[model samples]
Target: MEEFNGNDQAFTRDSLYGTASEPTYAGVTSFMRRRYSRDLQGVDLVVSGVPFDTATTNRPGTRFGPRAIRTASVTSAWERHYPWEFDPFDHLAVIDYGDCNFDHALPHKIPAAIEAHAEHIVQAGCAMLTLGGDHFISYPLLKAHARKYGALS
Candidate 1:
């Protein structure tokens, strides 16, 4: 288990797989625990966020959306929900794979960053549920999905 002394947190290597190398971000396992109550052995769905809004009307903080959503998801976990009775966690595996790190210094890099990041997830054979950094982020996400699944038309 990898232990962090500053936050008094400890997580196994398995829990940290596929997570960013930086310690600031939460691991997939921790995100899953915050979002659902089930083991993630054969999860069918993936919930991800793309917090890279360089083109927003007010662009200063849209990059923070991923962190905000993750916080809210953790808060909502213990709250009562109708689906709780059905144990939705047992049926599905949900995770937040953190956010796509944008190169704010080079705004033009956003499209490629978003495309590559989303493609990694799609290629892993997981369904994506993404939060937005900006509207443009969705375009690359859709394109990546289309490349993987082919165009509907």
Candidate 2:
């Protein structure tokens, strides 16, 4: 575990696919293994990759959006500026929980897997920030969250 700056926190890497000799960009293993400046217990946000883009309109590679976002977020070195003058990474606890596993053989399995995973996260008392395979992924995420926390009614 590595700490950025003088922060006394370490990020843990968790993979659903198990470990491999090399990292995988298309799966959850790569996303979870990135270093960050916070601990899971102290995390205010858990960003995850939900790479399932069966409904892509143009390019099909949008399914990889989650992995791309995770890479961008971790590699970013932007400092905060404004009323608050601290690094956002230093203050907010965020982790990449990696991608939700979906069955490519069965299209319906995508939504089911997403909902199940999101429910578990919500039940754990953490807010889920997810990457999309497509915009349609939002529907299951919201549905699961709403079921647990109730809708905006």
Candidate 3:
């Protein structure tokens, strides 16, 4: 197992229930170096990105948040995370679903796009870990989540 986990498990591993010990600077930069899969068969969680920031009243650079976050996640991809007794990947089948696809030209429709993206995962019985874009991304995310699991704070 050590021989396999020692390399790029992001696209090489056959399973989604273990850790990836690839060099922090190399390999597919998926969230936590997890496999970049759209298959939700038995997945417990889906990490996706929403690169939309046009709605922000402040700076409009948040469109790149998702990519930035994915890059940063690499620094902590190996072994057990600090302060935690166990690695979540060891128990949960997590995958990087990549970024939400939407027409940035149609800002009005981005919210619905985000909502639907989340709904697909939730409906599949998998949890979501959305990244990037702006806080407004929450508006659509919460709506999708509420539909699946009921009221949320």
Candidate 4:
């Protein structure tokens, strides 16, 4: 495979497609080294994080999982996803939309925040693959996705 030269493709690339050229150990980390943007203009997918672990009981480290996942993703961005003959990025425009913002001090508002965050992506004509924060997040995520696309059934 030929080497790519676009360092920090996550933030530098102009197109919605094509692979990043950055070295695995360098540059800012984004999902699959995709662009870091909320613009969603031609974006086909948004990888956003909830990062809310307040609902967890036994473990509370989920808030850090999104970043860890993004970091780990660096190693695999250089090639097509395993077991597949094609590169997903060659056809899809994906981005790391960053984390959902909410006032953690106010637990009651978290669900709405999550829903609104998801709503923005859906409204932008992009599908989302959210990193887990806590199981409770699913409740809001489901509601958000359903509201945009219809009933889960």
Candidate 5:
């Protein structure tokens, strides 16, 4: 397990390289207790939420999925990620970049919004792990990633 000084390591820490000190039930809720930031300067990977559920075919409650996932991850983040026995934070620089922004009234522009949001992150030389919105959101995300890394093989 990684070590931290106190609560709220998310704000005080300068890099995404260390584990958070916040306890499972307290402090800010970021994915794996990573810092919440938009700065991608030296970040290796970004975890962001896509709270859109408009494209879902069935239940439309995925908009809240990201937050719930982040909250639940607190317990797991305190230790190495399962059987892997290795702390990813020790190698990868990651941060929770918050959620993608879009205007709910403009349904047709949603895909574009998602693509643009992801594109910005990819363009900054950082990989992304999106939380949730709907299965359809992956299509736009793929497009953005492909544009950055080239055709997936």
Candidate 6:
């Protein structure tokens, strides 16, 4: 078990690696309790939220999916990942990058905003695990990723 120094490791922990020791219910919510940081230095992967749902004409509530997923992940963050004896954090450096910021009013710019946001991270040599807003959001994300890694499947 990891050492428990206090709580709110999402904001308090300084390292980009290791499982958080804070209680699941007591700390700032980040994906799996990973620290919230924009710095890509030494980071292996970034879990970012893209909260835009204007494309989902039939179901517009998908914008809230990212936050809901993050909140739900709080519990799993402190527990051992299933189907494995070890935590991936033991060898990986991950962080929760919060969400993509864009003007919802400017729907045309949303795709670009998400693309740029992804480009910034991918360009920094970091892999992304995005919590999406809608199915359409994948277009921009894939475009950005394809630019870096080429023709994503």
Clashing pairs in 4: 10-35
lDDT of 1 by residue, 1-153 (tens): 122223212233333222122233443333433333223345566666787766777556767777676655543343235654544544455555656767778878879888998888788787777876767788889899999999945
Question: In candidate 1, which residue ranges exceed 4 Å CA deviation?
Answer: 1-42, 83-85
lDDT digits (tens) for residues 1-153 of candidate 4: 224656787777777687756789988888888778878888888999888899999889999988999999898888777799888888887888999999989999999999999998897789999987888899998898898889996
Candidate 1's displacement at residue 139, Å, is 0.2
Where is model 6 poorest over a 10-residue stretch in terms of lDDT?
1-10
Per-residue lDDT of 102 in model 4: 95
Count clashing pairs, candidate 3: 1
**Candidates 3 and 5: which is better by TM-score?**
3
Residue 116's lDDT within candidate 5 is: 98
Residues 14-119, candidate 5: write the lDDT tens digits: 5678665567877777888888898898999999999988887769899999989988888777766657866889999999999999998998999999999999
Candidate with better TM-score, 1 vs 6: 6
Between candidates 2 and 4, which one is better according to TM-score?
A: 4
The residue-level lDDT of candidate 4 at 35 comes to 79
TM-score of each: 0.68, 0.68, 0.92, 0.93, 0.91, 0.94
Worst 10 residues of 3 by lDDT: 1-10
lDDT of 3 by residue, 33-71 (tens): 888899999999999999988878869999999899988
Which runs of model 4 end up more than 4 angstroms from their true locations?
Answer: 1-3
Global local distance difference test of model 2: 0.59
lDDT values for all models: 0.58, 0.59, 0.86, 0.85, 0.85, 0.87
| Candidate 2 per-residue C-alpha lDDT over 1-153 given as tens digits, one digit per residue, 9 for 90 to 100 | 222232111233332112122223232232433433223565566777787877886778888787676555433322343566554444455566666788878997778888988887777777877877788888889888998889745
True-vs-predicted CA distance for residue 70, candidate 5, Å: 0.7
